[model samples]
Target: MHHEAFVTATFKNLKPNDVEFRMSRSSPGRYALHEFMKNVYDLKVTDGNGNALDVSRPDPYSWKVNHHDGTIKVSYILFGNMGDGTYSQIDETHAHLNMPATFMYMPNLQNQGIEVTFNVRDDLKWKVATQLKHVDGNTYYAKDLQYFMDSPTEISNYSVRSFDVDGQTINFVLHHNGTEAELDAYFEKVKKIVLQEQKVYGELPSYDYGTYTFLACYVLNASGDGMEHRNSTIITSTTSLANGGMDGNIGTVAHEFFHCWNVERIRPQSLEPFKFDQVNMSGELWFAEGFTSYFDDLSLCRAGLISQEAYIKGLIGTFNYVWNSPGRQFFNPIEMSYQAPFVDAARSVDPVNRVNTFVSYYSYGSMLGLALDLSLRENGLNLDDFMKMMWTRFGKHEQPYTVTDLHNTLNAYAGKDFGDYFFNHYIYKNEMPDMKRLLNNVGVSLTQDQNNVSFGATIVHGIISQNTIMGSSAYKAGLDNGDKIIKIGDTVINDSVDVNSIWNTYQPNDQVPIVFERFGKTQETTVVLQASNVYNLSLFETNNLALDKKKQKMRDAWLQTKK
Candidate 1:
């Protein structure tokens, strides 16, 4: 339907003859350029006395009112349809507003206090929910533009669930077509995640207003995402709580909540003062986002909401993804993190060779986190203590930390030698730790399926879906992305053909003739089958071996609940 939010920015007491009102090009919790100005239209500037004023655009995102009365009311229509953490959406069902996407503000008045009153749709029985301080009616107050922009609002006929933990209130507001029973069930697990994450840092961040809100819009029209703020987070998805969303979307809730401690308070120096007018890139995203990703599922396991098998299985994806990546040959963790501006939800029409050139900071850092945690456990310590130390020295004091601070802190907590080795080899050099030995300390065995045949390209309907991995069998055969194999040896590849079954008939080091389509031309080549590079992770007892007391105790201590 027609999705739009009418905004009226009333600016008064102008210090000079002109005022610049701008729509933010960036938002918090993300590292991409959104250019929110594109969605704003029908802009009309007028005086407080209801007289039209002269407005000029000096830049694409800014509107300058020159030689005008001090009082100016800038009104515009913000057309938003994508309901996620970074954008806004308004419809007859609800008005989900992420601040930067819905509001315009005076450039010089960032430090000035602000108040907004949401004129809700009484016909739909809509109400306002936000992290901003409630004034009266449907109005709210923010200390400054920074706080104002950070506070996202949801207006709908939503349900609320609240609980007090450590004298701080946690609110869960759900906008969905689900039953109250479903909400109650979901909130119960949310409580477990909250308490378990709290156990990690030994406490919660002192929320600015003694409350933290989870603004969740699970309507069919919403997009899927989770973004963390100082005292709140916005989690939107198209999946309803009754439709497998309870299991699927809970991970995002856990992930965003952890950020209140890690990225939000345990501040990264590069993102200390978040920029609104430009893209913000930080080299510590490997630690900022990746480490939080590690804790997201780990928290679920520690809370007993998920089984140990599922938790261990979760490690396989990030582990193989990070370890198998060829991007490490070029960029270290810090350098890989610098790619956030290009990869963090950045939009482009051109094709990119990301498969071979890039590794996600999320997966890269998460595997590193797994490695560091296991390594720390080997030294009779744990990652939890290191995080706690981080909170005490940096987060609690609100001192923004750099990469060196992280290294020095690890050195102080683990040891000079241990920290130096982790940083020099793993962090700075893009090398991986001995994860196999570290995981084996807890009775999990890591092995490679080298005896099996390997074809390192994903094929769907006789077409290669992605770029072939370097050094893989397909790559050795000169196969690249978009090559459609018509026949491999005697097996004709098609929609009905199973590539795996064909590969099963072959042995490692076997060579076969292949015919494929490339750029509208048929080609012939001989492909040499290589040893499978697949890595398998299994528990010692799963392989019919009993864990020793030492390893069993270590596993229990690592996975068990703190309290």
Candidate 2:
């Protein structure tokens, strides 16, 4: 599968100086610098008279024209063969395009309008799905470069479904290997999620084009990603609906759809006017991305797509991961949000100490959202009300908000002193929230494994140590990262032997002989197995007769859909 894109732009008015045209270095939803200009080649520039214009190759990314008439015509052939939410791909099957990776823009004329025309093969029966307004047969119009770059187009012979909500159209464009029955069943769940999220904010923000398109590709050759736009979202995955069921793909849809209200409109001020050349970092992703993740699964439970027990298990898993991570001792939620440029889709060959020093803002922020929601519920206010207030103040107006704006809004809802204290401790300081206490307040029990014997560190593949919690048995015994465990208690450690089985043979405070390899040398040490203090939280049965009446009432209200 191979293809080429013939793109042309006409410059009407220009001064007698060098005009620069270049591809984007970074995209909106992606935090890393992707150097998209590397895939473009076969560039040619000419004046209106069809004479060759003098073009200069100043850098690897840009082309400069010095001697051009008032009208300049630039044409280029883009070679794209990979697909995701942030990159462009073209093949015999379809053409998946992310605009920043496909189009070239002048830095000076970024404020001007853009018109793009796609010349599709007549025999292929291809149709376009995007947020850009249609002008005619194959041409689309964008008011400015930002809007053009934010839109992604999918051209294929795919399955499409549409449903009306609040007098607006919600289109689901699917390109997958699946049956029509499976597709219909999957979309039913999607419709429920959309409606449930809308109930949280009390309403959906007005769409830019009176419609929202979910451009989804669940193909065998595609990578997984979900990126949000103004009126649409790009969702791609290697999992098929027929084989993996709706569970594999619906989470991404739930997350990206919620972003339409969170990050797309109630945006971080730093990311309001997205830059295509450099990484855009913001401190509010804990709310933007994190809070959305928290609600995505909750929305599933509320919509009856998932059971309440499944929801509680999911919450337990999230709480365990975030609370036990050693990175929490070093970075707060806001501090972790600043690490996106290095972690979010950014690649590196050399390994670093990310395990010991980094916790994903997604998980951390989700935990923060959960704790805050439960805490606020005890105070007679809920996160749903807080989100509605935010939507009313910022999202309704398409206003870009800052950290201060969030603090002010939260202060108004949850007292001035409490808001300041919450922000300082949870967002600014590297302190873990009291999840045990907070959960108990809502009639849930948070318990720890007190009698089980185990080394405290997380073992990767039963070989390498990843993160050893401070003062735990693993850290006290001098186990560190990159150390390979060769044997435990004279039993040779292998892939077949379960590590936990060996630990379970002994009780807490028992001495166990350990052998490990580090830095090309084998060493012997004595590990005293201790009871793990890390809270492995699980939701107690809500039907228990011993539960307090008031606390059960609080839990019931917390789980129900907000009016």
Candidate 3:
């Protein structure tokens, strides 16, 4: 029943005037504005002599302390009940601490070193797992505010597994309801993914503290999230490892670990020194996040954790999602990256159609990654080489990079003209690359499922919701997006009814009686079903003898694991 916790920060060497203390409006991995100060209350401030200080709150996120001595102590109580990689929670079981959501800092002293000490309850047995350098029994050290905020602390008596690679120790701290055997098996797959990702970059990045921690909280009540840090990551999920949830968990682990190089170290120029008070938007997240998405599944296939068929199925799913999204006609990958602050975990009380003009940077970027990889392969190069080059030029040196840096690297390796053309069409403009042609070169077939019939409307909530009528049969039948489909040929629509399966029984051009409810009025119409020209991409059967030698060589090279 412990729903609240207290935090006290003591500031020394203050300016002896008004100093502003603030909780972050947004966090690093989280693109949405959280307004963390909303959950904080009972703020108290005092001087070194224990005299109350004059505090003025200019805004909800900041508090201005006036009439303070050179040293001041500020304390507040925080209320948190939800647990994820981005939010903090304190309960009877454990304390999940996200620095940005739990700690308040002075904007002026952001570059100063910080030391944090935890006062563990004597009755509770909790162990600490974080990337922060340990000073002694209960204290930890961080070089700067950016480093401190990126580190998430998990104080729980969890099971731990350790492995070493390239002179660095990787620790997996798990607090979940899973057996030891299941945990060990999952760790083995994680090790393989780590090895494969390291191989792509040619080497692991220089860890700041010579250790990387995977702080995972897999509980039935926790929300799913995985946030990448400088030397570690926080992955929380409601799924149990003993069940069928390990595969999805592995995908998140691989994705965040890949970000250790892509977003954490490679560094977007706009987000280098992260802004806590405002949204930090970058145009290169197409590579920072999207390319990482591309490798998340590819690494699994390379690790032998998933089959080639399964991997291709995943790719086809992405292709279907991105290609079908209407936003592609209006926004490119770079534009979508810029839209992340508005769409990533965003919520709105009013209805505005985002489906018409919002493509996920993650999905679109992965599609671009696939297209570029195959395109580069046509020129005797691969995406792996490009990543390694970026690691050397920007990531290894810890230099902040921009879209221009990416273009320059691509031009240097794949020719100036080709790079210009690729960026112009795929990144600058809303033009998708020739996926069919690119995939064909690798012995894969990208085709559309023409046999599938649909009413040409995307339905939701067991009703024909907004944005449903997209020039399909439903649109032609005078049924708008807000028209709720109540019945189809006298068969009443309900939660159990599979709308697609119902339409599958009929063919294109077949007229069917449809009844819908719209704005408190019942309407009837006849909809002529149309073929859903959805892309269904798959690799050609490799087990047979009809495969071409050159195509087989290409596929082999594409799927080969680097050592």
Task: Give candidates' CA RMSD values in order.
Answer: 1.2, 2.1, 1.9
lDDT of 3 by residue, 470-506 (tens): 5678878888777788889857888888887788788
Across residues 459-514, which tens digit of lDDT does each residue of candidate 2 receive? 66656556576667888899887789988897888888888778878889999888
Off by over 4 Å in 1: none
What's the count of clashing pairs in each model shown? 0, 0, 0
**Model 2 CA deviation exceeding 4 Å by range:** 3-6, 456-462, 465-472, 542-545
TM-score of every model versus the real structure: 0.98, 0.95, 0.96
lDDT by residue for model 1 over 166-217, one digit each (tens)? 9999999999999999999999999999999999999999998899999999
* Candidate 1 colliding pairs: none
Reference-based TM-score, model 1: 0.98
Which candidate should be chosen as best, given lDDT against the real structure? Answer: 1
For candidate 1, give the lDDT of residue 4.
Answer: 78
Of 1 and 2, the candidate ahead on lDDT is 1
